[model samples]
Target: MVNANKVETEDEYIHVRFRDPDQFDEIRTPEWAEDPAHSVSEGSEVRMGQEEGSDDWQVESVLIKKNVGEDKAKDQAEEIVEKIES
Candidate 1:
């Protein structure tokens, strides 16, 4: 996921494109999966849900599997910023 701090409110919903482990390129979004209902902190895992006729995937919940110390969080943030800048 992109760094939460760098994301603006208006650009919260992003279309993601990535390569899978098997070397296949894929895009994982439905047209309606744009209007997310919740925001998550950096390093949190999120669950997305879609209503039958809805156009966006809602944020169902967030899971913080582990707590990162301030130093590590800062490092991660910096790495994210570098990625975005490049």
Candidate 2:
């Protein structure tokens, strides 16, 4: 199962560990959050998708490791939907 981490500071960027034992890929904050659409708030869930001028990788499917804090996941999910619509 995917684990949600508590983002304390810059040291706390999302660390995605592939569940597949054979797969080994790490996506950091600045690197993973490459597209302008990919943002990280204190409490919000951001999905991966292309906006306009973004490259091919822009519109890929990325499920961010969520947070354990209170209502953070729900808030983030809502924010992401808003962003996508806008």
Model 1 compared with the native: what TM-score?
A: 0.28
Model 1 lDDT per residue over 1-86, tens place: 43333221112322111212223222233333222211223433333455555554433322332354344433443343333334
Q: List candidate 2 segments past 4 Å from native.
A: 1-37, 41-62, 68-70
Q: What would the TM-score be for candidate 2 when compared with the true structure?
A: 0.29
lDDT of 2 by residue, 1-86 (tens): 22333322223333222223222233123343434324644432233433345342221222333443335543443344344444
Question: Best-fitting candidate, measured by lDDT?
Answer: 2
lDDT at residue 54 of model 2 (Cα atoms): 38
Q: What lDDT would candidate 1 get against the real structure? A: 0.32
The residue pairs found clashing in candidate 2 are 44-76, 45-76
Clashes of each: 3, 2
Locate the minimum summed-lDDT window of 10 residues in model 2: 15-24
